[model samples]
Target: MSGEREPVSREESSTVAAVQEEAEAVALVPELLISDLLRYGVLLSLSLVTLGTLVTFLRHPDYLVSSEALQRLTAPHPVPHGLRDVVVGAMAARGQSFVMAGLLVMMAVPVMRVGLSLLIFRQQRDTVYVAITTAVLALLGLSFLLGAAE
Candidate 1:
């Protein structure tokens, strides 16, 4: 065979380019999803916190209690109890509960992103990444469980 190579047709070259572009787009889906999760999660959390603050100030213009009194009241129990209690209190228009819920939502965003990554890795049949992601998820779950037990 001669050392010279045959020129590829325009149609063939376009088809190859299209295939590459499609592959690149498919690969970007997970990244895009993660970005959206972070963006929307922060926005939602900020909205909740802002709404809660507005409602609190509107409902109690003079403040719920004196700053010193509030500090004394909360100093004994700095950390909140559980999600159920927070949700119930928030439903009752408790400003602190609303803030707590927003914080929880913010914390959950990264966990959700990790979960999505695990799913994407599994779908792509990437065994190494799937295992690593699973381990990370397991550690996260364990940390939550341990914290709750305390």
Candidate 2:
């Protein structure tokens, strides 16, 4: 044998290319999912805040019908709050509550991205990314816990 390989057929080459394309698409699933999640999250957050603003302005010609309420909303010093507070306020259908909830959703998106990444990496058997994403997610959780303590 002169080390010459067999002549490649066009059909065979196309089949191989198709398989490779399929694999590439499969690999992209995680990325696509994450991107879609982030996009939707931002949209949802924006809509919530917009709705809250409209509701507040309409309900209280001057935003909650009081300058104090507006000041509280725009205060430089963020009032330390909890999920329970947000939930309760939102349940009351208050504009401020919806705005706060929207902000909370915005803050949560990145954490959720990391978590979703870890899950996808694990599912795809990518050990390195899984470990890295897991650590990131853990750090995020720790920070939230520490922040709540303050």
Per-residue lDDT tens digits for candidate 2, residues 1-150, read: 334343446567888999999999998898899999999999999999999888778777865457787666687876529899888888888887898888989999999999898889899899998889888988999998998798
Instruction: Extract clashing residue pairs from model 1.
Output: none
Q: Which residue pairs clash within candidate 2?
A: none
Write candidate 1's Cα lDDT for 1-150 as tens digits: 233333446568889999999999998998898899899999999988888778777776666656875676567765666888889979999887887888889888889989999999999999999999999999999988999999
Worst 10 residues of 2 by lDDT: 1-10
The number of clashing residue pairs in each candidate reads: 0, 0
User: In candidate 2, residue 69 scores what lDDT?
Assistant: 76
TM-score of each: 0.79, 0.76
Each model's lDDT comes to: 0.85, 0.86
